[model samples]
Target: MAFAVTSSTAIRSSLSTPLEQPKAAQVGAFQPSDRHHLPPAAVNFSRRRCAVKPLNAEPKRNDSIVPSAATFFASEVVEKIDVEDYGKLAKDLGNASPLEIMDKALEKFGNDIAIAFSGAEDVALIEYASLTGRPFRVFSLDTGRLNPETYRFFDEVEKHYKIRIEYMFPDASEVQDLVRNKGLFSFYEDGHQECCRVRKVRPLRRALKGLRAWITGQRKDQSPGTRSEVPVVQVDPVFEGLDGGIGSLVKWNPVANVKGTDVWSFLRAMNVPVNWLHAKGYISIGCEPCTRAVLPGQHEREGRWWWEDAKAKECGLHKGNIKEQNSNGGVHANATVQEADLFNTNCVVNLSRPGIENLLKLKSRNEPWLVVLYAPWCRFCQGMEQSYVEVAEKLTGSGVKIAKFRADGEEKPFAQQELQLGSFPTILFFPKNSSRPVKLSI
Candidate 1:
């Protein structure tokens, strides 16, 4: 699905970019070329209950939003969404049709919310929003590298809908810096994350910061791994909104459960305009350089970032959907295997909270240690086990300790607060001299 963008100056202020570069390592040492920007401060999620309720159980909802639509959402219930009631909103609307879900979202948030418009599925969202007969907002990110056909389609959509599509462009200085240092197509060699951050994710972050909620075109069928579990509605796990921090931004995926064939049918029936790239077999379109057309019967995600590993398909926009679980099943589904195989090695030291704390207290160490804060369920972490084991074996006599910290389940918050842990497979290099560790982007 498509995401929002922002004016360069605004994005430059709001975006916290992550760096990607090659690593030059030594025993117990690494010259880190990675940089990460942490959230401004942690936003506490109060009710530790599940964000999605039981689909069969009738959800108990108090109009978390106002009863009547307004120019902007002056909330009828100003209470936060992560509390008991709104937490179950997604499941309550889980089985509802896309149109019904769209109506509900627009009715609740009013002009305070906006649609991240682009792609076929997203344009369909606009059509559904229009059918609701409500005033809604739509925005998009212009990466300066989109297909010519996509640009024409954008103009056609604005004309057809009789609406002005607010556009967010990438930061000029950031783009200039990247091109000057890395050249235009560095992503082909290194990766797409750095380029995408400047073009899409950062601008979208700025766009979301001003709103209470957003609507997306994400569907399970759009991609294989990342969007599989997207809910029709939920408190955003990743970006913050006008109210600030996690749980503040509500993301509504009206077509989360809709399939590809169904979306096409809806569009056809409604006479919705689609990008010409689709006719060329480009089922999943993003920036021009990265996306390509897929062959028949191929999955849509295959069109985007085809060069990268299947697990690296998702851009930073919907990283929350990068669930830390393997294809096998739910979290801790591979507990037995993890105990016997994953990270259970002679050279790798598994550290608990107290043990890690004690290790951090050391002002000077006999050797450097490489620690990975990871979850057993994360597929990415699972894939890297062999490589990590090999490194541990190689460094055995180098006085380097390759360690791991279990950051899943109840220990997640502690890992987040103390260890800067945001996702699975976090690798931090604890240098020999000081406790401060630098994260390596690999």
Candidate 2:
């Protein structure tokens, strides 16, 4: 909702340079733009290009209860809200309340986490913390190009709270040079994402570093695209690298359970810091240049980048992250392997002691055994290790046994014979009577 500016030098060292440009068709082939100042070694050749998606889809089902102006502020959680549901939404704020949701969220998340305060829902969060006698860290991204109103709110919040808000600014010199050459509004004419790359997205990646978990103002009533079932606490892959490669372990959205009218009621009741622009009917806020007023029937996100093609409403944050992470060629972060009996035929068992009776054991036991070949070093393989271990444990009580074979390093002869049969993390299911195994690639 808002960006905070801080001293520049510290900002530069704290941030990882963003990827150069979007990737083309070739897998694992991408050029790093001069957007951020990432080192060459950290370039991550395996990182794939991420595609951006619009934010105006029906809010994720998980966010169905988010209060919005269109809903007339009802707090009811509808079971089947669709794009058409917007037309039938109530405009009153009787049931949908922000304060009630904040109370519930605080009780659940505790003081161990912070929220993504961008000055929009930020006012409510700040006031709620003060009123409830709960102290929490206030964090926000400082994209060098923030609106003046947001800064005023920042100062006001600090004065009211008697605490310094953590300011996450962009690299000073990098922003200066990029803005100088490209011009301040280049992103408006060319692509807003480019501007976001240099400001919001990259800076956010840096600011999120070292946080154990965080809270966001995201709600379901905002868009159809986010309407999926929302989870109170979930792993956010976007910030996975925040703390030494593996990022924040948890993300909480307490407002995910709250809707719109509730926010205004609390603001009035608590006399929270209200933004001047909101008085002019701006329900949501972002960069002033890119954001506009939403008409009565328009989607909540219709105001964002209104000049762009309707289908291209979103900036680079959400879309790019999902695209790059889903692709097989992309960096492996979240991976899971599920194994099941591929064939009806009973499989043979193969038993052997590492040092002795290899041939004799194989000859004596007619049934073949299932073996999972994996490399511990491979990131993808690492994700599957737990699943394989679970299978090994499950099969222990049953007559079927599971065997683990390292694809590389040790047991060269055995590795070459069974483990080396395919790429790392490959599963081989051998039938009860057959010597040959079926390769399972997931």
Candidate 3:
């Protein structure tokens, strides 16, 4: 059993020609029942052929690998099936053709579901929906900071699918408070974790409150951060509140193993619309001001927040549940905790000379300089680093005098008492002779 959208005859027909394989009826001549299962050698040969292209149809390709339906089915088998069926299913799957596996998963997940669209490779998921006639709930986060191009893509997807996409917004009050106090790009200045808690995680938690499952357009190929073996039905802890208190929400990554190039080809063939930002080389689309196109041979997410010092590349939505019941009192909401009470701290290894501080203090004497405070282990911090780097590069040798500080240990006490900083990467502009910092909007 696996979670997947079942394809209909019409959908199959639309894709049949591209497959350029013998007709199903003609191919059926070689069909084997229980015994029809090919021997291990034959299995390898048929799998190799199927891997190159769909056995019943021609394969639509992209960059990394041409995804045969086999991989998707293989990826979902564990998450969607009973333990008893797993061994036989795994053996059968290792031998059975790709087409059969895909058919089985789709049958198990059903067609009615929501596809989480971020205006990225999500289009491929949409293409699958269109080709399969599996109606899906397409949704996007109106983070209010998204680029105009993303909004335009939303409109385009509507026209292309002839369906209404659900819109999710962050809590108005929370957003207002966070933005008003921290500024728009606060995520960059204040550190990504808190910013995501306000902008992405909270909103996403609220948005997914009622849904049983969500289909993300995310692929393992996106980055090292998302490299875990994705399961089709895993509980999402962040949205635990969505469960109305118990076993609230489960996530299914239908495109978990989908490659970027495959998504692009699918989009092209389906005449699927895309945002103009992509043409500018923006592969992973999100908040416009926060994202950029990657250079050749670069990681797909390398262009994002290119100016930051940390490596957290996620926006919080993709992070597994971070909430933990605290013995002290409130719940601790870190997605990954190595050990209890041992919150992964992000600190800078300062090998720089102490004279640097005097220079920084001297520079802060002229104009308000925006400095970002952060840690290395935070994913949100990692995600925003690319954008920060770009910002720093643009302002380099300029009068702004950009600087960074790690908020831990002795520096933590100084940061709290002197700067009144409560979050990581607090982007504050230090004005001359002033105790108060003029906070700049990210």
By lDDT, the best candidate is: 1
In candidate 1, the residue pairs with backbone N, CA or C atoms under 3 Å apart (3 or more residues apart, or in different chains) clash, namely: none
- Model 1, stretches more than 4 Å misplaced? 1-84, 327-442
Residue 436 of model 2: what lDDT?
A: 51
Q: Which candidate is the best by TM-score?
A: 1
Comparison by lDDT, 1 against 3, better one: 1
Candidate 2 TM-score versus the reference: 0.49
Question: Local error of candidate 2 at 328, Å?
Answer: 22
Mark the regions of model 2 whose C-alpha exceeds 4 Å error after superposition. 1-112, 227-229, 241-243, 316-442
Query: Which 10 successive residues of model 1 have the least lDDT summed?
Result: 24-33
lDDT tens digits by residue: candidate 1, 1-442:
1112222321221011222222311111011112223333333322211121112222232212111111211122222332324547788988999999998887666555788886445789888877776566678888998888788787777656655566777778879977998899999987787788678876777777766788999887776445667788876766766666455667889999999899889987876677778878888788889989999988888888999877677666776654544347753321222223255556799898898887778888777778889876565565455456656755667667789988887889988887878787788777788767767665
Tell me the tens digit of each residue's lDDT in model 3 across 189-217.
64556555556655565455434446676
Worst 10 residues of 3 by lDDT: 24-33
What local distance difference test score does each model get? 0.66, 0.46, 0.48
